[model samples]
Target: MVENRPWMTFFTHVVLILGIALLAFPIWVAFVASTHTLQTLLNPPTPLLPGGEFFENYYRALTEGAKAVGAPVWSMMVNSLVMALGISFGKIAISLTAAFAIVYFRFPLRKFFFWLIFITLMLPVEVRILPTYEVVADLGMLDTYPGLIVPLIASATATFLFRQFFMTIPDELVEAARVDGAGPLRFFKDILFPMSRTSIAALFVILFIYGWNQYLWPLLITTDESMYTMLIGINRMLASGDSQAEWQVIMATTMLAMLPPVAVVVLMQKMFVKGMTETEK
Candidate 1:
């Protein structure tokens, strides 16, 4: 549309196409591996085109699972779903309430608490893993759903996102609600929440991906095979020091692990875009 500059437009398209190809290359390799026989995949420059055994590989992964790690793919996927949903909803709920209070109320040490959260952002999970594990162990949370999800749910990023959005809301809306005798809870339910739907959707997409892709925390917390997430279980499938790695099944599971997050992003793309635009304004 800006269009007197055809060369600029053509260059832009070339760059985008190359970017897409680069991003898609790895996925294409994985997908091709999923369709191949294991022996063929192990050998040489590997087949670029897909071969037979696609259904056989996927069926084995979903049903019987890896021989050594026999936890079903379905079970692992369910566990992952539970963890991801728990984290996303838990973070959104707690973050919204905390942000509301921080933005709207006059409380002692509120600024202190805000800065404390920001400080935690600098101290990532990797840094405090030991102390956090100790606290979880003391609380009898280890190897449980609470162990897997609870610590990760209280995100500084989510809290800040909500706080910034809340600040953008005009004071007049709250004043009008107060004039109409609306209590804080009532005003939040009837007004603020409705306006925050897009933000929530956007956050859901990001948080779901964050939770779903978590490897280190989940690996540390859940000791039980039954509690293993898809990501963790997929790693289990890849290779034991004893057995040859099942490239076909592993690739299939990788593709499966990729699905729910991709589905969430694709489905919520419009709301995500709208939220990003509106929140910035």
Candidate 2:
């Protein structure tokens, strides 16, 4: 038997609405600011409603970009999209294979290798960036998509997570695959891959955002304006050294940058929840 309290239900709904408002308020303000002129935004107290300059502001941003950033907003967004997708897929693929080998392969020093990969979690990007940059420079990958994505693609966290999930898969399944005369790759392709869909969805969302927001590595490696990502381009767009900032264009760019990640989350919300919460495979 369950007791239903009307007041508690009402309070819960109130809290949920307030939390949503608090989070959404800033995004709403940004959208409104993006629809106005620089001069209009310069005045104190931003407008609550969207202004009339919606298409003009967005058109200028997509085509002309800001004065400080020479590249068009669309180009920067494309670069970000490429980098984010590459990093996400690359990390997931590599992590999945790495975890597969670690769990199933019986090679000597297997535990040692797994520990080596796991130890890397302690070394954040800042710590090994210099060496990584040198290696990338040596390979002549600077200003290329490979340069932006390759070094950052190897993720210990994803590897560890996939390994844990692989460990949960019953030995009976492995025996069944073997009984069916399936090879290593076939077993993985038929069984493990399909079973890991939800986990992959969750990781894809997270890794996509991580790659999309990467600033320091891309900034350091990319000298060409065409190769700049949304974050780098936005950073460059900030006014400095006696130059006046264009808040409308910046706001418009910000809004545009937010769309892809939001779409990914919305589309994958169900799988992401299952991946995070569901324990039994």
Candidate 3:
């Protein structure tokens, strides 16, 4: 075993390096492409390294090209931020309340309700798209903020996760809370929720990423350019005529759109890890 340790270590290092490279390759390509001129990007296939004229490409893309899109990039970014955060907050709130009630309260047909909600997991958004679209349209919510945020409010996955985490908490703490004259609501607010902070944080990260990356729903619901999310905006930029195509701008815009989730992941790395481990426990 001792003699083979060196080979094992070398093999592990090689695997790790390869994994990192594979993960980073797309990002590297995007970054390099972002720095190239339109002429180079439009040429047969793009080059490997960043070409000269990074600033010129950025300037044209932002100011005078297909990616410009009449409105400022900042405006589009803010629109995306509001939509993503709204979905995140709304989803978390609904999931937490539903999970808490189901897990902690005794009520009629509770298990049935739980199972019914869980059944939603088997159905993809695509499967329900037409009905959901009709509902939103009938509500006159299409092409609006409420349309974007409300449909995502009840996440079955988040409810299941929170329920599982709540179940793992020691019953003794809940009993102690009851002994102190606390009711179910008070106990949930004061005891269960505080203990499940890590799990909540993890869910926030997951939900935020989901909301941020949502493209199809946004595309389908929003028809106005002013209401377009970053993803839709980028797609529009890409689909413009060949003469107006702006690859450098597309790369930069994509990188900008990617930054928020990346920042969230980095900032909450510890909480995210803790949440996963605590949920498992």
Overall lDDT per candidate, in order of appearance: 0.86, 0.89, 0.80
Error of 3 at 261 (Å): 1.9
Higher TM-score: candidate 1 or 2? Answer: 2
lDDT of 1: 0.86
Give candidate 1 misplaced runs (Cα > 4 Å): 1-15, 271-281
lDDT digits (tens) for residues 44-154 of candidate 1:
789889889889988988887777677878889989999999998999999899898888899899999999877877888899988998998999988788888989877
Candidate 3 residue spans exceeding 4 A from truth? 5-15, 51-68, 270-281
Candidate 3 lDDT, tens digit per residue, 1-281?
45768889999999999999999999988988988876787786778888787777666555543544655456667778888889888977888899998988899999999988878877767889999989999999988999988887777878888888788888998889888999988987888778877677787776787788988898889888778788888888878765576778888788778999889888988866764564445
Q: What residue pairs clash in candidate 1, if any at all?
A: none
- For 1-281, candidate 2 gives per-residue lDDT tens digits of 16799988899899999999999999999999999998989997989999999999999999989988789999999999999999999999999999999999999999898888878878877988889889999999999999999988878888988989899999999999999999999999999999998789888878887889898999989989999998888888885447898989999999999998788778888765664454223
The worst-scoring run of ten residues by lDDT in candidate 2 lies at 272-281
Which is the leading candidate under lDDT?
A: 2
Model 2 stretches with alpha carbons more than 4 Å out: 1-12, 274-281
The per-residue C-alpha lDDT of model 2 at residue 221 equals 96
Q: Please report the candidate that would top TM-score against the real structure.
A: 2
Q: Clash number for model 1? A: 0
Ranking by lDDT: 2, 1, 3
